[model samples]
Target: MHTQRISGQAGQTGRRWGALAAAAALVLGAAACSGGSDGKSAGGKVELTYRIWDSTQQPAMQKIVDAFEATHPSVKVKIQLTANQEYWTKLQADATSGSAPDVFWMNGPNAQLYESNGMLLPLSDKLAANGVNLADYPSSLVSLYQHKGKQYGIPKDFDTVGLWYNKKLFDAAGVKYPDDTWTWQTVQEAARKLTDASKKQYGILAPAFGQENYYNTIFQAGGSVISADGTSSGYDQPAATAGLKFWTDLIKDGSSPSLKSMTDTFPSQFFESGKVAMYYGGSWNSSTFAKNSALKDDVDVAVLPQGTKRAVVIHGLANVAYAKTKHPDEAAALVAFLGSKQAAEIGAKESGVIPAFNNTQQAWVDATPGFHLQAFLDELPYAMPYPTSKNTSVWQTQEPITFAPAWEGKSDVGAVAQKMADLMNTALSKEK
Candidate 1:
């Protein structure tokens, strides 16, 4: 979607992201971080470092840190943050030097990598001691941090993919808005009708992240991202290939923007500006969307249309402690405080994302007027998660090259999917 700038804002098209800061403040703020605890920590007067990415979330994280500090006056929390990629790289460097932060955010892809290399201290016992229940979290996320029957982290909260659309564009096209009942077929038809290359408006943005962008679609077509064992590629699996074809066909037919256009566009601004009619992403966008005064009321969300099957991917984070911390007890206390309903609610209210904990998630959705963010809440039951296995990231780096033609509009998507499978297998063999 393109924006009509009245001036002020930097970027290719003068799209302003300044509102994101205010949008983040619109809902819950520190309640998310503090609601987690009222208990005091054991006396140690220990100061430990916590790390995360995304300065956008820093205020919320700092609030969480402050609450942790208040509850445990003896335990002081220091926060360190960086971009997502840089955070991981720096954490890895710290791991090599045996100087990692006490607590850090861990996700599916590298969760196992950290746990397996002994960089993360397992929390199953700590959780049990604190009376924290794994049953409270979505199963996919709980399982994502578990390897070989041992859980190394606590399930923070979960998010699901959705269809965000520009209401203005829908009005212009004389098409009704999408809702929970819309299907992939209906979305495609709308895209074909709504698309106008002359205006640089396309149907959707199909990014290259297999797990982030295509995993939901692939599995929605009745396929799994990986085998039951998490040992082999699921791309060559027939259902998975058919799933890849579904979106690739849209690109092939020009119903969506080319991958190049996607990379070049300032995405956060585009969705609100109406340059793209629908964005297939997750609920995390709720806060960002709520902030845009230019598009807030005019924009909205819907459940992701079903593919051959009805499903959603459950993406979430795990707050894992470092293995080599000098403050293991303090780290454990922080994790427990963080897992409490209060902390979860703080994250929900401040972050505008669903709280990983039960009950608290509703508070966030209830706070949104017309958003009914509950669609993602309902999707939680049907979400799937995949942790980066020892070899997953290796294939991830190569996925765009293998899956390129599908979105590039040059080759048979199914064939490229098969080639993707072969390439992954080649990488997997080297892992042994």
Candidate 2:
């Protein structure tokens, strides 16, 4: 649920990151103003700035910071909360001006951009020296922040997609609730039955989204977004064509609302307001749904239905330290502590996010009762990591533009997919 774009309340990734320019010059220019180790006060007190974009998660993050401060008596950590829309821009400006935070949140779309430019401090050696074990976190998450075989961020939390349905709608349609046994055919059938054109009620909310929609299906259909070596695009593959068509077919069949309608009003809003019966969203939505008094009681989630196979896209936020931080030791210490089981436990009990630390996910499931939150955790075994490359944002920005015609029912999905493949390949070829 972490990206560099307009991160929603569910912490879902956004798709709008600009390619960084003059990164090396920004790094060197920041060294003198980073305050260096000599800036410590006479009392030897160190102040470290930790920044994050999601205000919903600030309370839990603050608790983690407090715990770290408790153990490291001389360090005072300040939390900087910025809106997602401005987070990356502000970070970029700060980096260029030598005023970036000591540590901050990092996501898949921008990780390589910052890491490859030497903007983020490598955590492998420090984590090992601090007795922190990367094995404690999800492997997919651990690998997400790695650039050129070195880790730059510590895995914080993870989220996977699920199928959320309204019991009231299913009951009205006399359709059985979805479960692990459900397949693509099962969903299509149910969607057709539940949809009522007269009532303006769609069976499902299928937006032209990656992690929440096509990415999972692409993997389930045995296709991938990028090749293993990150040098090619998979959009032209037959499997990818099938995956892309899944949503377009729904639009064409009148089972899902038109892409324009879904775009005008977010799919989540449609589901929350009862305009749609089912929604494919991330695990982060559990807390959001729980808070909405109107839909909380009637909403429940299930594993994503199978295509060729069962799959979901997994993504997470990482706690990354700035390489130019003056208090390098303190910054790394805070990062290490944040990645610990204790911090993950705090986040599980307090925050809505699923902790990346192994065995702590149950606490999150237990935290939210009645809604079968476990569906998100259950898919982890086969969940594919959210696809990324040295500059993932390059092609990510092209997805909706390239697929809009098919989504609007004005073009063939297969044809649009091939066009997308060519565009993605061109973007990949230009990467350093």
Candidate 1 regions off by >4 Å? 1-44, 266-268, 366-370
Cα lDDT tens digits for candidate 1, 1-432? 001111111121111111111111222221122111123334545777777665656777788778877877777787887555356556555665556678887766666556655667777778877768888877877888897788888876666767888888889989889897898889889988888899988776666655445777788888876666767778888888777777786777787777786667644555666778887755666666777777778878888888887877775677888776766777877877777787887877675556787778777787676675777777766777752565456666666777777678778877888887887777666644
Please name the candidate that would achieve the greatest TM-score relative to the true structure: 2
State TM-scores per candidate. Answer: 0.85, 0.93
Segments in model 2 whose C-alpha atoms lie over 4 Å from true places:
1-38
User: What overall lDDT, based on C-alpha atoms, would model 1 receive against the true structure?
Assistant: 0.68
For model 2, how does the per-residue alpha-carbon lDDT over 33-137 read when each residue is reduced to its tens digit? 553233455566898888887776889999999999899999988899887778777887787677788898888877877776677888878987776899998
- Cα lDDT of all candidates, in order? 0.68, 0.82
User: What lDDT is reached at residue 357 by model 2?
Assistant: 90
